[model samples]
Target: MAQAMLLSLRRISRSFGGIQALDNVSLDIAKGDVIGLVGDNGAGKSTLIKVLAGAHDPTSGDVILEGRPQKLSPPAEAQRLGIETVYQDLSLIGTFTAAENFFLGREIAIGRGPALLRWIRRKSMGDTAMRGLEELNIDIPGIRSKPVDRMSGGQRQLVAIARGAFWGHKLLLLDEPTAALGVRESREVLDLIKRLGAQGLTIVMVTHNLDHLWQVCNRVVVMRRGRKAADLASSATNMEDVVAYITGAKEPMTPRPATTEAGA
Candidate 1:
C-alpha cells in the first residue's frame, strides 16, 4: 500500500512587494514522516514554513491539507487544525513557569455561567502540563513551576517541544530547533525529534545542519532562490549533494527509493 499524503502545496507562491519569496513550489508531505527543509539564507525556506504555519498567506496557489483545500489565515486557525510550530525564538515567556508557558494563550478554565465566575485552573494546568511532557518521554526535573529563563538551553527546547506535543495532534513544524544549542544539547533535541517521530507524529524541521537531517529526517527538501530545488530521500542522498543543491552547484532532481512512509 502507498503512504498517504498529509499536506500538499500546489504551485504555491508568495511575494513581499517586488520580491518573490516562494515561486510555484509544489510539494507533498506524508503522514508520520520527518521532513527536513534546507536552504541557504534568503532561499525562501522561512517563507514556506510560515505559509504552512498560517503566518503567511500565499499570493497565489493552494494549500491542501488531507486532500481538501484550506485557506489557513491566522496562527490560531492552524493550531485548531492540529498544526503547531516551534520557531527559532521558542516564544516562551522568560518570567513564566513551564506550566504557564505551556498554556500561554489556551489556558484551562473552570466554573461556568458568567465570565467573572470562571477562573484559571492553575492546579489542573500544572498537572496536565506535566502529564503531557511525561507522555512525550521528556524528562525535565522541576519542570512544573520553574521559570523557563532559569532552565538550560536544552531544557528550554524540551519544554517548547513538550508544549508542541501536547497540542500537536497532526503536524509539528520546527524552525532551527538546535541552532544555538551546544553539542550535547543538540543531541538531546535530535533524540526528542526521533522519539516524536516514533510515536507517529509528522514533523517538518527547518535546519541548515545536514548532519542533523540524517539523524532524524526521512526525506529532505532543498530550496534555492524561491523554488523547490531538490526533493530526495535521506537514505538516497548525501550531505555533499544536498549542499550542492543549496548552493546552486547542481540542478534540482527528485531522487527515489524514499522511506516506506514517504510516497515522494
Candidate 2:
C-alpha cells in the first residue's frame, strides 16, 4: 500500500532578480520519506531546500503540508509548522554545551510573575536534552555539560540533528549532513538518519554523496539548471544513472506511447 502524502511542492519557483534559481518544480513527499535532493553547484538544489526551509520565499508556487497551503517565511513560521532545517555549518554555538545549544531560543524558565524575574531552568533543560538523545539511541557522553567546540565534528553534527529531530514534528531538512566528517563519523550520522526515518520523520536531505543517499534515502530527486530532472527510487536506480542525471549526461526518461497492431 502507498503511504499517504505528507507534503507537496506545487510548481515551485524562485528567482534572484533576473536569475531563476528554481523553475516550476513540483514534488510530493510521503509520510516517513527520506528523500535525497541532488544536483550540481548551480542546479538549484540549495534554492529549493531554502524555499522549503522558509529561508527563501518562492517567487511562485505553494507549499502544501498535510493538504493545507502554508505561508512558510522568515524561518520562525516554518519552525512553528514543524519544519526544521540543519545547515551544513551545524549552526551550533561553539561555546555552548550540547544541552544549551539544544534549547537555545526556547529555554525553559522557572518563576512566575514577569519574564525578567524568571530564572532559566538549566537542570530541567539538560535532563530533557539527555532524554531526547537517549531515546534516539545517541550516546553522547557529558552532552549536557560538554561544550560543542570541544566535541568532535561528528558529535556536533549529531547534536544538531538531535535538536532538529526533537523539535521538528513534521519534516526535517538536512543540508550536506556528512559533508565534513570522517568515514566513521559519516557512517554514524548516516545510521542516525536511518533511525530518524524509521521513527516516522519525513526527511529531505540535500547531499552530493550518492553512497550515503543510497544507504538512507528511499527516493532520489535530481535537479539540473534550476529544474527537476528526475525522481527515482534509490533501490531501483544505480549510482551511474544518478550521476548521469546530475551531470546532464543523460536526459530524463519519458514514457513511450502505447502501440496498436500494425494493421488494426
Candidate 3:
C-alpha cells in the first residue's frame, strides 16, 4: 500500500526583489517520514522551510496538504492546520518555566467571554504539559518550577520538541535542533527525534550534520543555489554523495525507489 502524502510543495518559488530565493522547487513528504534537509549557505533550505512555516509567502506555487490545497500565507493558518515549527532560537521565554513556555501565547482560558472575566488556566496548562511530556517518555526535572534558562541546552531543546509534539497534529518542522549542543546532548536530541518518529510524527529537520541525518532521517533532500539538487533515501546514499550534491560536483539522479513511503 502507498503511504499517504502529508505535505507537498508544488512548483514553489520565492523571490526577493530580483534575487530568487527558491526556484520552482517541488517536494512530496509522506506521513510519519523523517526528512533531513541539507544545503550550503546560499542554498534555499531556510527559505523553503519559512515558506512551509507561513513566515514567507511563496512568490509562485501551491501548498497541498492531504490532497487539499492549503493557503499557508499566515502563521495562524498553519497553526490551525496543526503544523508547528521549532526554530534554532528554541523560542522559549528564558524567564518562564517549562510549563509556562509550553503554553506560551496560546494559553488556556477558563471563562467564555470578556478578557476581564476570562482567567488563564495555569494549573490546567501545566497538567496538560506534564501529561504530554509523560506520553512522549521525556523526563525534564523541575519542569513546573525551574526557569528554562537555568536548564541544560538538551533539556531546553527537549521542552521545545515536547511542545511541538503536544500541539502539532500533522507535521513538525525542526531547524538545526542539535546545532548548539555538545556531543552527548546532540545524541540525546537525536534519540528524542527517533522516538518521535517511531510514534509516527512526520518531521522535516534542517541540519548540516550528515551523521545525525543518517541516524534519524528516512530521506535526505539536498538543495543548492535556490533549487532542489537531489533527494535520496538514507539507506541508498552516503555522506559523500550527499556532500557532492550540495557542492554541485555531480548532477542529481532520479531517486532510487522515488519515495520512502512504503518503509516509512
Model 2 weakest lDDT span, ten residues long: 255-264
Provide the overall lDDT of each model, using Cα atoms, as 2-decimal numbers: 0.88, 0.89, 0.89
How many pairs of residues in model 2 come into backbone collision?
0
Query: How many residue pairs collide in each prediction?
Result: 0, 0, 0
Candidate 3, 163-256: lDDT as tens digits: 9888888899999999999999999899999999999999999999999999999999999998888987899989999999999898865533
TM-score, one value per model: 0.93, 0.93, 0.94
How close to the true structure is residue 124 of candidate 2, measured as C-alpha lDDT?
Answer: 94
Task: Supply candidate 1's per-residue lDDT for 135.
Answer: 86
Q: What residue runs in model 1 are displaced by over 4 Å at the alpha carbon?
A: 112-117, 254-264
Per-residue accuracy of model 2 over 46-77 as CA lDDT, tens digit each: 99989888999999988888888988898999
Weakest lDDT window of 10 consecutive positions for candidate 1: 255-264
The CA lDDT at 225 in model 3 is: 90
Query: Mind giving the per-residue lDDT tens digits that candidate 1 earns over 1-264?
Result: 277779888888999999999988887888998999999999999999999999999999898899899987699999999999998885799888899999988888987766677798989999998898888788887766789999998889989987887798899999999998999999999999999999999999999898998999999999999998998789998999999999999986643223322543
Strongest candidate by lDDT: 2
Residue-level lDDT for 99 in candidate 2: 97
